[model samples]
Target: MTSNAENELLERYGWPIEEMDFGREDDPDVIGCAVLEEVEGGTSGIFVVRPGLDEENRTGFAEWAVQRVGRYFEHGPEPDGWQKRSDGGWQLWVRRVEMPPI
Candidate 1:
């Protein structure tokens, strides 16, 4: 609902639940990914938890869908390869890009 609430949820993971379809960037597919369609409210969304890097100040992607779902509360949804599934669900794939060898 509110950003504070969202932040509170993300505080533990460090993955910013970036709004889905908020913006588009030049990137490729990632290695790991996750898609979450709320089992209750029916609010569908997606996010990625990388192993080396996460949302803001962390490293790694969620190892499970159930865990990834808890990474909710984003201002909107995920970014990049996040897509809408046939079941009206959401899907997020890791972006495939080299971070300039950083």
Candidate 2:
């Protein structure tokens, strides 16, 4: 996708697009981060999108990510974590950070 298209999607979703070293030597596309504010007094989480995936997989990944993140905030517990699956999808994981006193 063109940079303009990427920018438009980011604008629509209110997600911040950032470039980071994704630890891949040949990957050219920059990774994006969609940060959601903390809810119910919980820590915020980052939703990562791998733009380097194939076009078909990118669309599927985007859809899967949206649903997964929505479920986390709406029904799941607070401070949930996630990672991209090796098979080209997302997987929600339990966060393991030290929390401040409540």
The global C-alpha lDDT for each of the candidates, from Candidate 1 onward, is 0.46, 0.47
How does residue 71 of candidate 1 score in lDDT? 46
Worst 10 residues of 1 by lDDT: 56-65
Deviation from native of the Cα of residue 72 in model 1, angstroms: 4.8
lDDT of 2 by residue, 1-102 (tens): 524444444555554433344554454433334444554655344445554555554454455445656676576533445444464333452222446999
- Candidate 1 local lDDT, 1-102, one digit each (tens): 324534543564444544333223444244455565555845544454434443432223333333445544443345333466788566766544547764
Instruction: Report the Cα lDDT for candidate 2.
Output: 0.47
- Candidate 1, residue 85: the lDDT equals 74
> Which window of ten consecutive residues has the lowest lDDT sum in model 2?
88-97
Report per-prediction Cα RMSD to one decimal.
10.6, 12.8
The numbered model that scores best in lDDT is: 2
